[model samples]
Target: MRLALAQLSIESAAVDDNVERAVSAIETAAEEGADCVALPEIFNVGYFAFESYERAAEPLGGETHRRIREAAIEHDVSVLAGTIVEDLAASADAGEAVPAESGLANTAVLFDADGKRRLVYRKHHLFGYDSAEAELLVPGDQLPTADLGGHTVGVTTCYDLRFPELYRRLVDDGATMVLVPSAWPYPRVEHWKLLPRARAVEDLLYVGAVNGSATFEDASLVGRSTVYDPWGTPLASSDDDATVVYADCDPDRVDEVREEFPALRDRR
Candidate 1:
């Protein structure tokens, strides 16, 4: 499958403009013959703009995703439309799982080539270090996966990269590839580079990570969207600029690597 990672620039708190930007990126990826396009976390609202999270929070089928879904159908390409700041109460009223307390969710939704909703992945882990995400948002309880691009794809958000157990759970659930939509900041570039590749190498699966492309005031996003093979080799990567990165990944490669190495079988 040909994967296109959209490294987009987020204008702080500019939801509509960012959605338009994301659509342009999707169109570019489809024109390039990409099988799927993944956007960055909080692409519509800047991750550092914590104050806007509540105000910008929308329901699951809100306008942001509606626009993206339309693009997915028009372009005939699968889209992992990054993530949206979701209102948990709206989801609860919609009959989905509601948090114990009233709050928001960092939710990622997948749209198929036909513009159908495939999966709704709420970020399992919320960022807390030097940030208010943990206090402001509720962590996800469910782990959702999608069947797409000839692989079982699982979605995880930014800080979830630090936790391998989550990825291991995904592997156990027959995930052949994992796509991460992140809003990673600067000064932790080394950690950002190492973790995703490590997850792929250890699990013997493809790891596709897409991050935001610009730095915000006081906090900055380091754009290095990358794709890793099952063998942990870098297939494609972008620098700290807003651009698109693509990689051709074979779903069978994970099975090939796992059968050759059989390391996952030795786990205690």
Candidate 2:
């Protein structure tokens, strides 16, 4: 399998424009022969645009999703359309029984090449350190995984990267590759770089992190969208920019690496 991480440059509150950018990025990735393409967290409204969360929030089957569904079909590539501000109220009003309280969630949506919605993962870990994420969003109770491009792919949002337990649970649930849709900002580049690599090395799964690239009010997203192999090797990476990073992946490489290292058997 081949993956393309769309490191988008997100501007605050530019919903329509950002969506167009995402579509363009997806098309580009498809042209590059990527089997799957993943976008960043809160990309439409921008992560720093806190005021727009409630207003910009969409239901599970909203226009944003429709556009993405179309894009996925048009490109013939699976898509991880992630970290959309999901309005729980809208879903509840639409007569669907949401498991969480009436609020919002930082959500990820996955679509196959046939334009079917495969997975919906609300971010389990919300960032509280100098951010309003924990206060603004409801934590998810479930971890979802999907089969795509010869890999069992699991989903997570930006802040979930700091939690290793989430990844471990995903692997236990049959995920050979984990997709992290992040809107990580500047000044924490080291943490951003090492955490996914560490998780990949420890868990014996491919870790793909896609981050936003643009600067927003009070915080600027430093784009270093990276993909790590099971042994913590950087397959593909990019500097701080709005571009697509591509990497060829082997779904069984995790087993190959783990079998050679034999470190997971030592786990207590």
Candidate 3:
């Protein structure tokens, strides 16, 4: 499978413009023969735009998702719609299960080439250090996985990478590839790069770490969107720029790595 990571140029509170960029990236990735394209976290409202969260929050089937679903069908390529600020009450009103009936959540959705909603993963770990995420959003309660392009795919958000147990759970759930939609900031570029590489090495699966590119009032994103193979090799990566990183991944590679290493089989 060919994977594309859309390291978008995010602007704070610029919903329409950001969404437009995401759709364009999807089209470009499809044209380049990418089977799946993943966007960065909060690509619409920007992760550091805390004040705009309430105004930008929408239901599961909101306009952003509608546009993404349409794009997935038009391009005939699967898409990970990155993370968005979700209104839990509105989602419940729309008959979608949410972690809470009230308040907002940092959520990510996945769509197949046929425009089907395959997975919805709210961020399980909300950042609390010098941020408002923990106080503003509800943490996800479930880990969901779906099959896409001959790979069992899983979804996680930025801070979730710090927790290796989460990726282990996905591995137990039969996931071969995990897409992480992140809005990681500057000053911690080493952590941003190291965590995903470690996750891929330990889990024996493909790890696609997608990050945004923009500077906000308080912080700036460290782009470097990358795809790490099961053997912890960087297949493709980028600097802090607005671009799409592409890599070809084989689902069979995961099995081969695991069988040759036999590390997972010896887990206690």
Candidate 4:
């Protein structure tokens, strides 16, 4: 299937503008004959918009998700509406104090071709160094996967790239491909490039990293969205610009690589 990685610039706390940009990208991707498109992490409310979290956060079926669904239907293609800041106020359990304003969550939602909600994956590993994500957000419990056009796809967010165990579990659960939506900043471009390829090689699956092109504080995003095949070869990549990277991935290649190499068979 042909996948489009939408690497657009995000304005911190500019919800309407970001959503409009994402919708436009979806239309463009569809016109290019893409079967599915994935956006960058926290595309709505920029990743470092901590103070705006409470104001910008939305519920699962709120406006943000509704806009994404409408875009999917209009474009007639599946969409991985990248991570959003979730408001868990109403769902808070007893004695939880409602988290004062509501805790944030790096949540990714998937919509099928017919605009049905296919899956939702919250970010498992929250980044804390130089960011307030660890203090402001709640970690996800479920490792969600979905079937997208004959491909068993797994979903993960930016910071989760460093954790190989999570990808291993997804591979064990029959995921042939993984989609990572990221808002990775500058100065750590090496980590952003290497980690996803490493995961793809180690897991023997296709890996797609969709990143944003935005500046936060003094940090600018490294908009090198990339796709890696099972052999750890880059099939498609983008430079530091607002563009869509496309790749044609075959699920059978995963089986072929694993069968020929038998690396996974020797796992302890």
Instruction: Return the lDDT, model 4, position 29.
Output: 96
- Candidate 3 structure, TM-score to reference: 0.99
Q: After superposition, how far is residue 101 of candidate 4 from its true place, in Å?
A: 12
Candidate 2, residues 1-268, lDDT tens digits: the string is: 9999999988899999999999999999999999899999988889888889999999887989889889999999999996799998898888755657489988889999999988988888889898998889898888989988888999988778788888888877988899999988889999899898998888898999999988876888879999999888999999998999999999888778878997777877
Model 3 lDDT per residue over 29-101, tens place:
9999999999999999999999999999999989999999999999999999998999999999989998888
Residue-level lDDT tens digits of model 4 in 13-89: 99999999999999999999999999999999888888888788887767888999998998899999998987777
Among all candidates shown, the one with the greatest TM-score: 3
Q: How does candidate 2 score on lDDT?
A: 0.89
**Cα lDDT for residue 192, model 2?**
94
Residue 132 displacement in candidate 2 (angstroms): 1.2
Clashing pairs in 2: none
The lDDT of each candidate is 0.91, 0.89, 0.96, 0.89
